[model samples]
Target: MKKIEVFRKDKWNMIHVEIQGKQLVVREISDQWGEDTHIFLSRPALMDWVQERFSAQRFEGSEEERLSIIEKFKEV
Candidate 1:
Protein backbone atom coordinates (compact mmCIF):
# COMPACT_ATOMS: atom_id res chain seq x y z
CA MET A 1 0.00 0.00 0.00
CA LYS A 2 1.14 3.53 -0.77
CA LYS A 3 0.13 6.50 1.33
CA ILE A 4 -1.42 9.27 -0.78
CA GLU A 5 -2.11 11.89 1.87
CA VAL A 6 -2.52 12.45 5.59
CA PHE A 7 -4.69 15.10 7.17
CA ARG A 8 -4.40 15.96 10.82
CA LYS A 9 -7.73 16.80 12.33
CA ASP A 10 -6.19 17.66 15.68
CA LYS A 11 -3.27 16.64 17.89
CA TRP A 12 -4.71 13.19 18.43
CA ASN A 13 -6.77 12.53 15.35
CA MET A 14 -5.76 11.97 11.71
CA ILE A 15 -7.14 10.85 8.39
CA HIS A 16 -5.01 8.81 6.02
CA VAL A 17 -5.61 8.07 2.37
CA GLU A 18 -3.78 5.19 0.73
CA ILE A 19 -3.77 3.14 -2.40
CA GLN A 20 -3.54 -0.63 -2.28
CA GLY A 21 -3.44 -2.27 -5.69
CA LYS A 22 -6.39 -0.76 -7.55
CA GLN A 23 -8.38 0.13 -4.47
CA LEU A 24 -8.38 3.16 -2.22
CA VAL A 25 -8.28 2.93 1.55
CA VAL A 26 -9.23 5.65 4.01
CA ARG A 27 -8.22 5.32 7.60
CA GLU A 28 -9.29 7.31 10.63
CA ILE A 29 -6.66 7.19 13.31
CA SER A 30 -7.23 8.34 16.86
CA ASP A 31 -4.38 8.39 19.28
CA GLN A 32 -6.64 8.75 22.27
CA TRP A 33 -8.76 5.76 21.29
CA GLY A 34 -5.77 3.55 20.45
CA GLU A 35 -7.63 2.13 17.46
CA ASP A 36 -8.17 2.93 13.81
CA THR A 37 -11.20 2.74 11.55
CA HIS A 38 -10.77 1.91 7.88
CA ILE A 39 -12.85 2.01 4.74
CA PHE A 40 -11.93 0.38 1.43
CA LEU A 41 -13.19 1.48 -1.96
CA SER A 42 -12.71 0.09 -5.43
CA ARG A 43 -11.64 2.24 -8.38
CA PRO A 44 -15.19 2.94 -9.50
CA ALA A 45 -16.24 3.85 -6.01
CA LEU A 46 -13.25 6.10 -5.60
CA MET A 47 -14.16 7.96 -8.79
CA ASP A 48 -17.73 8.30 -7.56
CA TRP A 49 -16.53 9.83 -4.31
CA VAL A 50 -14.22 12.17 -6.19
CA GLN A 51 -17.06 13.31 -8.44
CA GLU A 52 -19.29 13.95 -5.46
CA ARG A 53 -16.53 15.87 -3.68
CA PHE A 54 -15.97 18.15 -6.65
CA SER A 55 -19.58 18.46 -7.66
CA ALA A 56 -19.94 22.03 -6.40
CA GLN A 57 -16.30 23.09 -6.57
CA ARG A 58 -14.25 24.52 -9.41
CA PHE A 59 -10.90 23.09 -10.36
CA GLU A 60 -7.91 25.36 -9.90
CA GLY A 61 -6.29 24.08 -13.07
CA SER A 62 -7.50 22.68 -16.34
CA GLU A 63 -9.97 19.82 -16.07
CA GLU A 64 -7.54 17.65 -18.03
CA GLU A 65 -4.86 18.23 -15.41
CA ARG A 66 -7.21 17.36 -12.61
CA LEU A 67 -8.24 14.21 -14.46
CA SER A 68 -4.59 13.35 -15.05
CA ILE A 69 -3.90 13.52 -11.33
CA ILE A 70 -6.76 11.16 -10.68
CA GLU A 71 -5.39 8.85 -13.33
CA LYS A 72 -1.99 8.83 -11.62
CA PHE A 73 -3.62 7.44 -8.48
CA LYS A 74 -5.08 4.63 -10.54
CA GLU A 75 -1.65 3.83 -11.96
CA VAL A 76 -0.32 3.45 -8.44
Candidate 2:
Protein backbone atom coordinates (compact mmCIF):
# COMPACT_ATOMS: atom_id res chain seq x y z
CA MET A 1 0.00 0.00 0.00
CA LYS A 2 1.11 3.54 -0.75
CA LYS A 3 1.47 6.18 1.93
CA ILE A 4 -0.34 9.51 1.81
CA GLU A 5 0.67 12.74 3.51
CA VAL A 6 -0.90 16.16 3.70
CA PHE A 7 1.77 18.75 3.00
CA ARG A 8 -0.48 21.75 3.01
CA LYS A 9 -3.79 22.88 4.48
CA ASP A 10 -6.30 25.39 3.17
CA LYS A 11 -9.90 26.24 3.97
CA TRP A 12 -11.04 26.02 0.37
CA ASN A 13 -9.63 22.55 -0.29
CA MET A 14 -7.69 19.69 1.25
CA ILE A 15 -4.62 18.33 -0.50
CA HIS A 16 -3.46 14.73 -0.55
CA VAL A 17 -1.33 12.43 -2.69
CA GLU A 18 0.06 8.91 -2.96
CA ILE A 19 3.78 8.40 -2.55
CA GLN A 20 5.94 5.40 -3.12
CA GLY A 21 9.52 4.48 -2.26
CA LYS A 22 12.03 7.30 -1.66
CA GLN A 23 10.64 9.79 -4.13
CA LEU A 24 10.84 13.51 -3.49
CA VAL A 25 7.94 15.18 -1.73
CA VAL A 26 5.12 16.38 -4.00
CA ARG A 27 2.66 19.12 -3.19
CA GLU A 28 -0.97 19.24 -4.24
CA ILE A 29 -3.01 22.40 -4.62
CA SER A 30 -6.74 22.82 -5.26
CA ASP A 31 -8.32 25.96 -6.67
CA GLN A 32 -11.18 27.26 -8.73
CA TRP A 33 -10.91 28.84 -12.16
CA GLY A 34 -14.39 30.04 -13.11
CA GLU A 35 -15.96 26.98 -11.45
CA ASP A 36 -13.38 24.53 -12.72
CA THR A 37 -11.14 22.76 -10.23
CA HIS A 38 -7.38 22.86 -10.68
CA ILE A 39 -4.84 20.55 -9.07
CA PHE A 40 -1.18 21.43 -9.19
CA LEU A 41 1.96 19.41 -8.50
CA SER A 42 5.39 20.43 -7.30
CA ARG A 43 8.04 21.40 -9.86
CA PRO A 44 10.04 18.18 -9.76
CA ALA A 45 6.97 16.02 -9.67
CA LEU A 46 5.29 18.05 -12.38
CA MET A 47 8.21 17.60 -14.78
CA ASP A 48 8.40 13.86 -14.18
CA TRP A 49 4.63 13.43 -14.39
CA VAL A 50 4.30 15.33 -17.65
CA GLN A 51 7.13 13.45 -19.29
CA GLU A 52 5.91 10.09 -18.14
CA ARG A 53 2.28 10.64 -19.18
CA PHE A 54 2.35 12.97 -22.17
CA SER A 55 5.72 12.39 -23.84
CA ALA A 56 5.79 10.02 -26.78
CA GLN A 57 9.57 9.75 -27.08
CA ARG A 58 12.32 9.37 -24.53
CA PHE A 59 14.04 12.55 -23.43
CA GLU A 60 17.66 12.91 -24.57
CA GLY A 61 20.68 15.09 -23.74
CA SER A 62 21.52 16.96 -20.55
CA GLU A 63 20.51 20.02 -18.56
CA GLU A 64 22.93 22.11 -20.66
CA GLU A 65 20.55 21.84 -23.60
CA ARG A 66 17.66 23.15 -21.55
CA LEU A 67 19.78 25.98 -20.14
CA SER A 68 20.90 27.06 -23.59
CA ILE A 69 17.32 27.16 -24.83
CA ILE A 70 16.32 29.38 -21.94
CA GLU A 71 19.28 31.66 -22.64
CA LYS A 72 17.83 32.55 -26.02
CA PHE A 73 14.98 34.46 -24.39
CA LYS A 74 17.07 36.27 -21.78
CA GLU A 75 17.51 39.37 -23.94
CA VAL A 76 13.86 39.73 -24.80
Query: What do the candidate models score in CA lDDT, each in turn?
Result: 0.60, 0.38
lDDT of 2 at 27: 37
What TM-score would you give candidate 2 relative to the actual structure?
0.24
The parts of candidate 2 lying over 4 Å away from their true place are 5-12, 33-76
Give me the displacement of residue 19 in model 1, in angstroms.
0.6
Candidate 2: clashing pairs of residues: none
**For this target, which candidate reaches the highest lDDT against the unseen true structure?**
1
lDDT of 1 by residue, 1-76 (tens): 7786444557676555787776668665677776565455576776665566434366455676567555654553
Candidate 1: segments with Cα more than 4 A from true spot: 47-76
- Judged by whole-model lDDT over C-alpha atoms, candidate 1 comes out at 0.60
Judged by whole-model lDDT over C-alpha atoms, candidate 2 comes out at 0.38
Could you give candidate 2's per-residue lDDT for residues 1-76 as a string of tens digits? 2434432335544333444444433334446522222233444554555346333454343555434423322211
Clash pairs, candidate 1, are none
